[model samples]
Target chain A: MNDLVENVVKGDIRAVARLIRDIDDGIPGVREALKALYPHTGKAYVLGITGSPGVGKSTLVDQMVSHLRRKEKTVGVLAVDPTSPFSGGAILGDRVRMQRHSLDEGVFIRSMATRGHFGGLTQSTRSAIDVLDAMGKDYIIVETVGVGQDEVDVVKSAHTTVIVVIPGMGDDIQAIKAGILEVGDIFVINKADREGSDKTLSDLRLMIDMDQKKYEDGGWKPPIVKAQAVFDKGVEEVLEEVEKHRAYLLETQGEIDFRRSPKRVREELMDLVKNRVIEEVLGKLTETGDFDAAVEAIARGEKDPYSACDELVLPRLEIH
Target chain B: MTGKRRIRIMVAKPGLDGHDRGARIIARAYRDAGYEVVYTGLHQTPEEIVEAAIQEDVDMIGLSSLAGAHNYLFPRTVELLKEKGADDIVVCGGGIIPDEDIPTLKAAGIREIFTPGTPLDVIVKWVADNVEPRGEY
Candidate 1:
C-alpha cells in the first residue's frame, strides 16, 4: 500500500492510472491510497469544460491541452462519457480527440464513464482528480460528459469552469439559461465559424449583461470567447481568459488552494460523511432483514411509514 | 470490490486505417458486453494505442487494422506495451490478415486473432473468459 502511494506520488503514470481505476471500481482499501494521496493534492489547477454534446468540448479541450503543453506544463485530463444504463457499459471516445498527446510523457489522459451517476460525472471523478493532483500534474482538465441543464456538478470541483457552446443551439440556449449558465467562470462559443454564431454570441452577451449588477458589485464577470476549435481559432484568447480568471481568484482569495474554497471543502466533507453514514446504516438494515420487514409491514398497512421509520432508526439513534 | 468489477478495453484502429466500420462495431459489442471501451478513433499509431491502453488501465487492447498494416502495427503495439512494462494488458487483433501470419503475430505476444465474419459474441466471451482486471487494487 505504501509502495503504491509512493509510486503515485512519484508521478509514475502506471501507478496513478491503476489507483484511479481502483477508485472508480470502488475497490476496498483504496481509501487508504486516497488518504495517502490527499496530502499531496492541492497543487494541480483543476479546470472543468462542459457543454452540450456535439458542441466540441473535446476539441476545445484538445486545443487547450496543446497550448498548455507548449508552455511546458504537465497536464492530466479526465474526459467523461455516459455509461449505458442497460448494459452498465460505455464507449469512452473522448480520448479519440486528444490522442495527439498520447505519447507525451508529460500528459496523462484518462477517459471515465459516468457509471450510472447523474450530473454528468461519475462518483469517482472527484477522487480521480485528487489522484491526478497527487501525481504532480500542473493542470488537471476535467471534461464532463457533454452536459445539459442541471449537470453543473463540475463547478463544485473545478477552480475555473469553462462552459462550451456552439453556434445555433436554438432552444438549447434557452434550456441552458437555468442551471449551467450560472456556473461558468468562462464561456466558450466554439465552432464560431458556423452560421448563426452571431446570434448565439449576442444572446450570451445579453444574458451576461442582464447580470451586470452582480459584476458591478465587484464579482468576477465571466468572459465569453468565440472559438473555432477545429480550425484552432480563438483558443489562445480562451486560454488567456482562463488565466485572467485564475489571477482574479488569486488576487481576491490571496492564495488559491487548487480551486477549493472553504465552502467547497465543507460541502465535500459533508457529502463524504453523508455517504459513509448512509452506506453503513443501509448495510446494517439490509443485513438484519429489518429493511425488508419494514417495507412488507408498510405494504400490509400494519404500521405507518413515519412510525416504521422511527421504529427502525429511532432505536439505532442514541437520544440525549 | 464486492460487486462485479467492470472490465475496460481499448478498441484502437492503429496505423492509418480508414476502414473503421469493423472497429466501431466491435467497440459497440464490447460496450454491450458491459465493458468500458475506449475507442481511440482512426489513424492512431502503435505508440499512441499502447500509451492510451496503459493510461486507461484497460484490461485489454483490441487492435483493429484493415489497411494491411497489422503485421507491423499489431506487433509494434504489443512490443511497445512490453517496453513500457504494461505487457499484462492483453493484446488481440482482428481485420484482414493471412492465415500464415497468425502464428507469427501470436508468437509476437498477440493473445488471439479473430478473422473477418467472426461473431461479436465470440470475441466478447473470449475477453470475459480470458482477461481480468490488470494489477492488484
Candidate 2:
C-alpha cells in the first residue's frame, strides 16, 4: 500500500486520489501508507490561508502558488469545502480556482471537505501531507473550511496563518466574531480598490496594536497589507511579504509550530484508541450475527439506544 | 449517499467569506425539518466539503457561491466528488445561477438547482425528496 501511495506521492494523481479515498474509508491500505510516510513528514513550510468568502482567497492562493513555483518551490494545497448537513456529500472544487497551478508538475492540489471531523482536518489530511512532504513539496498550504471557530482550530496546525479580509459590511463586533483576527499571522486587505479599504486596513492595524501579545516570545506581529487580487494588482507585493515572513520564521525558528506537537500526539493516540475500540465492538456485533434482530428491536422500540448501548456495547467492553 | 438515519449536513466556509447569512438560513431550514447541521465558518472550498461529507457520510451536497466562479468551481467539484466513488451522492447548486446557465448545470447531472430567494421549505423538502438517509434517528 505504501508502494502504491509512494507512486501517488511521485506525481501519480490517480493513485493519490485513490489513496485519499482509502484514507476517507479508514481502509487498511491507507493505514499502511500513513505508517510508511510518517518519517518523511515535517519538511514543508505549512501555510494557512483563510479569509472572508468574497476576499478572493482562492485567487490569492493561485497567485501565491505561481510565485512560489517561480522560486522553484514545490507546493501542495489542501482546499476545504462545505457539505450539506442534510447530505454528507460534498463537491471538492477548490482546485478549479487554480487554473495554472493545476497543470504544474511540481504542484499537488487536493481539495478536501470537513466531513464533519468536528472542525478539524481528517486523519487522511495528515497522511496526505506526509505524502506531499516526502515528494519534496517545500510549502504545504491548508485552506480550512470557514466554519467560524473550527477554522481557527484547523489552521492552528500550520506554521503560519494568513487571515484575509475585505472592506465594507457589518460592525466591528462582527469582525471580531469571525475569530480570524486573533489567529492571523498576517492580515491581508484583499480588494484594496474597493470602497473603505483604507478604513478596514486602518481599523485592523489598530485592533492588532490594541490587542496585547498573547505569547511571551513576542510572537510575530501581524502586518496588514492591502491589495486587489481580482486584477492581480498588488499580488507581487503580497507574495514578497509572504516570502519575507517565511524567511523570518526560518531564520528565527521563532516557534516550532507550538501547536503541532500536542495535536500530533493527541491525534495519533486517539486514532489508535478509536480503531481498537471499534474493532472490538464490531467483532462482537458480527460474531453474534444478530444484525437483523438488533435492527428490528431498535426500530420497533423494543430497545431504546440507551439500553441497546448497555446490552450490546457495554458488555462487549466488559469482556474485553 | 444512502443512510437510514437522516444525513447530517455541514455548510462550511473554508476561507474568509464573511457573508454566510445565506448558508446559515439554509442550515436552519434543514435543521427544522429534522437534520443535523455542521456549519463550517466561511470561505470553504471543495476539499473541505468532501472531507466533511466522508466523515459525516452525507447523502447530498449543497453549496452557495454568488462569487462568479460557480461555473468553474462547482462542476470541477462535482467531478472530484465522482472520483471519490460518491457518484451516487447528489450534488446540487444554488446562489445567483443565471436562468440560461441552469440547463447547462442540469445537463452536467447536478441533482437540482435552487436559485436565490427560493423558499426554505421547498429546499428542505427537495433534499428529502432526492436523497435517502442511511442511519436510524
Against the true structure, whose TM-score is highest? 1
Best prediction by DockQ: 1
**Worst lDDT 10-window in candidate 1 chain A:** A115-124
lDDT of 1 at A216: 91
Once fitted onto the true fold, the runs of candidate 1 whose alpha carbons sit more than 4 angstroms away are: A117-123, A148-150, A258-260, A285-320, B1-4
Q: Model 2 over residues A20-91: C-alpha lDDT tens digits?
A: 555544555456677776665667778888866656788788878887888898888777766555656554
Q: Candidate 2 chain A, which ten residues in sequence have the lowest lDDT sum?
A: A115-124
- Error of model 2, residue A139, in angstroms: 1.3
The sequence of per-residue lDDT tens digits that candidate 1 reaches over residues B44-133 is 988888888889999999998888888999999988989999898999999999899999999999999999889889998999899987
- In candidate 2 the C-alpha lDDT for residue A80 amounts to 74
* Residue range A120-149, candidate 1, lDDT tens digits: 243478889999998899999999887753
Error of 2 at B14 (Å): 27
| TM-score of chain B, candidates 1 onward in order | 0.95, 0.84
- What local distance difference test score does each model get? 0.86, 0.66
The best candidate by lDDT is: 1
Residue pairs in clash, model 1: none
